[model samples]
Target: MEAVEEVAAPQVRQCPECGTEVTVHVRYVSWCAACDWNVDPGAPDPDRGRLAQVRRRLARRYGEQLAEEVARGGSAAGRVGADRSTVLAFGLALLVHGVTAGLFLAAAVLIIGGWHTGIQPVLGGLLLVAVAVLLPRPGRLPQGAPLLYRADAPGLFGLVDEVGAAVGTAGVHAVVVDASANAGVRTYGFRGRRVMFLGLGLWEILTPQERVALLGHELGHFANGDVRSSFVTHGALRTLGAWHSFLVPASRGNLMDWLLNTLLFLPRWAVYGLIHVLDGLTMRASQRAEYLADAGAARAGSAGAAVALLDRLLISEGVEAHLRRESVTAARAGGGSGGREAREAAERELWERLAARIGSVPESEYERLRRVSARRGHSVDDTHPPTHLRRRCLASADPRPARVVCDGPRARSIAAELAPARAALARQVIRDHAG
Candidate 1:
């Protein structure tokens, strides 16, 4: 008998019947052990096997094209990971608290000195009152105008409808927020369904497919019930941070401020330290959450496209930078009919600039910093895994290590079928309801 060909270890053979890729080091045979399909050179697993072969062939070709695009200056953008809005809000609140506390401390010092510091107390009280009134109101989001309700845009209403249909669930509404470089879904009210929030700039930066992936990821959070947990965690952090924001400024002085200059400098590091701890927990959850979302996007359809888009976004300098560079590069690249190509050129230019600006770090210096950062294992109070980790997570074939969902070609098919419908619904939700 002719020797049965064996695919190398780890790299599994693509399934002929289901188009699912698999690996087996057990034994070489004339047919697939899992599906009982022919493996003989002349008699592959019938028509299904043939189809599988075709899919792989096409995927390989597409992969090559994508690689070329990347080589020729097609780079992905980065998501804005920092919660700038929250940080600013916290900062302002802290300033108010610190100023008020200082005033009180000064007045008490004067009283002790028998100088009758009555004005200080009045000023302190008024400042405290003003902060109390303003703190509860919405401060700002990272992007967009203000609110992200779907009723804001009419043209994209059809997109939302499709997403609802795919999940076979309701109590979900979509909105567009003027937040910075982030997009996500949330749930509010007693019912606790998914409340989707899309960033205004996200779509402008992402291709339609990538946008779908992002939406799917958010929806996945709802599907996986991570949204509730995340909200709970976020709420707790917010509450604690707020408390620190208020009290730290108050605590900056011991009895000394009363005895001396009465200066109550805000404890910036102390508050930030607490935040970093909270952010660490949030970051761990976030990494897992991203995987789930990626899966959701896969389920919605277009897994390859979704992954491809992610690769694109994550590799770029970032969305904000892209926006800053867009106009200048567009004018320079001028009159190109190919949008994708033009965009690629712009991104390539941007990266080259950034790389140049970053300049050449000495090999030894780069190594030292890399080691130090790794040892530190994430920054204080940032809810994100390292960028490298994120790239690996998104690139993973089986995202859920615990509960293994389908993967390889089978997984791709399932994702491809559902992605379009889901994407359409998402668009609609944002357009019709973001008012």
Candidate 2:
């Protein structure tokens, strides 16, 4: 008897909206390129609130404009001068600073001039407390991450220094390692000393060259000197946050309390408006700065590597989820009272396991990430432009060869330097997740 023939279903399907033929993947969203159907599969976060919604709208609008401009003519769109928005942003920041200064002067007068009046001291003390709350705190290095100096990790520092030079900036003064699925650079303390934070989760998954791309993008922030990161703007934002917290009226209790809150309504919302407008202005500049940084990424790590870096970032959510699962598994496997053995075993296979998962990602998955990113206007945050635009900008730019190359010896040396930090971080992860 002849056996019945079996047929496998095709991966292609029709879009419900446009009826256009589209290919579906088991692990990725299937979308119609022509109609953009299913391009945005994720739902919005209801808890993100109104302020977040406004910021995302601004990011999407400006990001699309910049993307088009970059596509048409590369550098000119990126060279947007301090426009009206920038001016307003700075003015608003200065106003915030001026308020802090005004508070100080008022407190001094009340305390010094009214020495004969007993109540003046009490009022002055309250004002001084207000001053302290409103004062702009400088950036601080993270306490959790282990620090590394140039001497301790010469190979890593040297590579960063090279990337910095390529991007036309001095390298970081110190390096700190963390277990996050991200990397960043920031000023440390009042002196504005530069420090770079390397996240092991993302770093472990990157090839040597992609790591260069990561460095390039971060150092590029320094070279470009994005307005939002400046002390003036950042300080203003922080101060605004403080003001918001301080002004939040207590819940209704009494008529006098209600009356007091009624009086504060204007001031409270006035600060709120400043926060929104200030963010609007600086966020635009920050997005533009991102394009400039992408250029630096291309120059330092090659256009291809830069694009690949963005693609890698697209899948970082998945990477984070995988890490959480791995953490739980590791905790369970440790099998001891404190799961000490589990921590050790997880650390032993941590990187290898992560690398294997990332390496096995199919091409279709990357494509899906790009599409979803485009539709949802995905970015690292409001400080960054959309990832799709970043990719497009890199693709449109003239192809560039890598300025800093990571060789086998240096890579090994750097890994060796990171060993202790990695182990400590692994143990910490297990401890946090262990049941």
Candidate 3:
């Protein structure tokens, strides 16, 4: 149950007529309070207004469903609920691994046993060896392992430990800071050790309270046992994908090659189809795990902060897009060595502008986001629930007050500790964009 990143929430905007902040209304229409400016002029269309109302009703209904599920102590209640689909997915993954392991074992036996036998056994051994070689190796950490920097900041580690303890999970084995705009926890290493990655993009935008909620949400995944199952399933999927690729015929050379390709096609197709089915089956449970983690976050911080964190993610999405565009534009404008610095400066400027804009966003916009998200519903590929459903579920759940462990000063210390790595990553990003 690695934490899955949710869609970015809605962004805040200023009044178009004047520079004054605007208020968002139903259907996400913006109006200037000061000068009577409206982003959508004229009276709110009744049809659009009705659609908004319908969206709200759907969100509320979904929220109620989630609340009732929580009340009934279903899968949403905690991490201990035994989900059959998850178990099935895990079992299927183990089955796939077992089959791969058997192939290797069979190859070993053929090679060893054939030493005293005739050439037939040796030929069989060689064939098995070739088959094993062709099979895709299990997915592992990337070379050089981007974003795997160890967190040495005492304050940051202390806060992480506190959050883990609060959420009833073993403390993370390591913390990583990445350049991406998302945070997640995944199990790594031979022993399935949990590692948490905090995105710098996400970090820059969040307030201390919101950050706490985010951390809690991630740590909660480990606490609920989602990490282990998710890691296994992910590994299995990767193995299956590799097998599929290997079985695909690169060329139709000779009769034997065609025969081999034809023989492998059915199995590969079956594995591919099985992967999709297992993925669909397990998706609901994965989503429930998300809601459970959200509940943990609500308990660790406040529901309000949890909801605000989701909103800020949307703002981060917009800011990230703008930054990338600006960086590329600057590089292409012939700034050369100075272009990198200019891009970084532009990034900082955009962040500040976006952060300021967050305050001016009308509450109605948040509601609109929730409504739209609710109406959209969950897709098979979605790892997290709709933002509005999450908000509603959190609002309905009981709240627990907790102190904010990673406040501004401590967060600053952490940024300072990781400054070198962040700088290196920034350069890499600049090069990537420029190239």
Instruction: Point to the candidate with the largest lDDT.
Output: 2
Tell me, by TM-score, which candidate is best: 2
Candidate 2 residue lDDT tens string, 102-144: 9999989999999799899789889999999888887787787
Worst window of 10 by summed lDDT in candidate 3? 1-10
Residue 19 displacement in candidate 2 (angstroms): 12
Candidate 3 steric clashes: 4
Span of ten consecutive residues with least summed lDDT in model 1 = 73-82
Q: What lDDT score belongs to each candidate, Candidate 1 first?
A: 0.43, 0.83, 0.64
Per-residue lDDT for 1-435 in model 3, tens only?
011212335545686667876543433456554664542343432454654455444444544565568767675686645567677887888887777778777777766777677774677677586556544343244344244333456666777778888888766767776667788887676677777887766776678888889988988888876622565677677777777777778585999998898898888789778767666556566667777888768767677888778776644555566446544764664466676566665443433443444545557655544444454542212456566566666776666676455667787877677666566655555556657
Q: Which stretches of candidate 3 lie over 4 Å from their true place?
A: 1-68, 116-151, 227-231, 249-262, 329-365, 378-381
Instruction: Give the per-residue lDDT of model 1 (tens digit) for 1-435.
Output: 011223354336777786655554332232343554543333322344654455434433333343333234332111213344334434544554455456556545544554366665565556456445433232223342334344543334334444434433342444544323566666555554445565534443454555556666566666554321444345445545665655444445677645432332345455555555444434433444444455566555455645654444432324455345444544444445675565444433432333332232223223333333343332212233343333333454443221212335543443344333334433333233322
Of 1 and 3, the candidate ahead on lDDT is: 3
State how far residue 59 of model 3 sits from its true place (Å). Answer: 16
Residue 364 alpha-carbon offset, candidate 2, angstroms: 0.3
Question: What's the best-to-worst order under lDDT?
Answer: 2, 3, 1
